[model samples]
Target: MVHYLYLHGFASSPQSAKAQDLGDRFSRLNLSLNIPDLNQGDFSHLTLTRQIQQVSTLFPPGEAVRLIGSSFGGLTSAWLGEKYPQVERLVLLAPAFGFLEHWLPQIGEVQLRQWQQENYQAVYHYGEKRSLPLHYGFISDVRQYCELQLTRPVPTLILHGIEDRVIPIQASRDYQRDRPWVQLVELDSDHSLGNVLPEIGLAIQSFFSLK
Candidate 1:
């Protein structure tokens, strides 16, 4: 039995619409899907290392898992696929490669300096509709994992939107450029990919060889 896991994006949760959609799709096929809360109750101490550790604890000692992740979670999935051969297959949605490079500039130097000084920055939590304090360690921790180049051929697939302004579609293009094994599916949608869930589901079904 394959252990299917869905890792949500930044500031998102297990209750995300995409997660639910996948959960429902898998459920109809009698497959169990796990969507772990990456935040782990402490948004202030959030880091990629911490999220990876949490995910690591989910599976048994020698078991493999099938991963589907979006944006920040996709970045995490890429790291996992590189480090752990146990990740038998991977699917990334609008992966945030070079995220730090894009993110820091958006926040600007002054804001970054202030965040470093204060140790935390207030960011909007979409689900809760309130600003939460995310620690600078979150940004600092990504530096260690950012340079990861995924060369492993773990049956990978990437679904990116053409009009995605959030992470930029070029990021996916650049990521898939040299890796011929990685299938890049471009959809006429936005960053959320909300309009193409059915297409996304079909792609996943085909990748997993599901009926």
Candidate 2:
């Protein structure tokens, strides 16, 4: 049986509308879907790693798994795919390839170092009753990890919007440049492709069918 794992964007929860839509689609297709809640008070690299490890442990061995990740989760999916060959297909939506390069310049090294030393956690409101913390370690860890690892080119589907202000669509284009197994789909919407849900769903269905 094919199992689907949906990872929400940074600061977003599994309860997000996109996650629910994917869950519903998986149910209709009779595929198992896991949407683990990554919210933890620790709000550090250790916490996020533990959450991902715990979620990964729940799946029985020898089962085919497919991953769909959005934004930071897309980066996480890339890491997971590199670490685990069992991931049959990876779908990334508006992924940020070089977050450190993009953010560190604006915040500066001194402030980032200060933030890391102080270990401050600033809560930002996401959906209702849901919040995520701004953590220096999280940003630093993701940057370090991506830089250290080689790009793992598993069968990948990249969906991005031309008007994405958060993460530029060109990032996805650049990521797909050298990767032979990547498929790029550009839409006219913004970072939030809520309006193109049906088209996204169709693309996902078609990709899985090809496999």
Candidate 3:
């Protein structure tokens, strides 16, 4: 039995369009699809480590598992790939790496400090809530984890839009540089890839069919 774990992006939830689409596909195929809601409780104070741990506990062992993560969830999934050898394949869609190293400068210390203080949660149309306390330390931890802990190579599929403004397509290109097992696919769309879902779905189905 093939089990799938779907992780949503930052400030996103299991109710996103991609997650729902994948869930429908898995239902048709009679495979198990797990999309855990990661935004409950005091998420504002929760660290990335805690978040990943909570997500990890949802999986059942002794079955072939695959992970598909979007945006920040992609980073989480990559960390899981490094930690869990049993995961068969990892799919990252518009993943962000070195987020703090790059995006922090634009946020500025004053706004960041204010954001931390307020602990605000803003809801978006996609059913995700942007939580406060966006820790710079989380970025540092992710960078170190990706650099040192990610020594083992896992079969990975990376799907990104060529015109993604939020995460940029170059990050995916740069990620594929040293990772030979990674397969990169570029779509002619923006960050959402709204026009290319069918193609993305087909590619994922094809990839899973192969050895």
The lDDT per prediction is 0.87, 0.75, 0.74
Task: Say which candidate scores most in TM-score.
Answer: 1
Model 2 scores a C-alpha lDDT of: 0.75
Q: Give me the displacement of residue 182 in model 2, in angstroms.
A: 0.6
Cα lDDT of model 3 by residue, 1-211, tens digit: 6678888876777888888888888778777689887665444444467667987786677667788888888878888888777777988888776555556677778876765565542323245343344444444445455444555688999999999878889888888888898899998987777688778777778878732
> Where is the poorest 10-residue window by lDDT in model 3?
121-130
Candidate 1 overall lDDT versus native: 0.87
Writing each residue's lDDT as its tens digit, candidate 1 over 97-206 gives 88897678889999999999999899887656689999999998998874446788777899999999889999988888888778999999998999999999999999
> For each candidate, how many residue pairs have backbone atoms clashing (under 3 Å)?
0, 0, 0
TM-scores for every candidate against the unseen true structure: 0.96, 0.86, 0.85
Model 2 ranges with Cα > 4 A deviation? 41-48, 105-113, 128-133
Number of the predicted model whose lDDT against the real structure is largest? 1
Tell me the tens digit of each residue's lDDT in model 2 across 112-133.
Answer: 7777887755545464354445
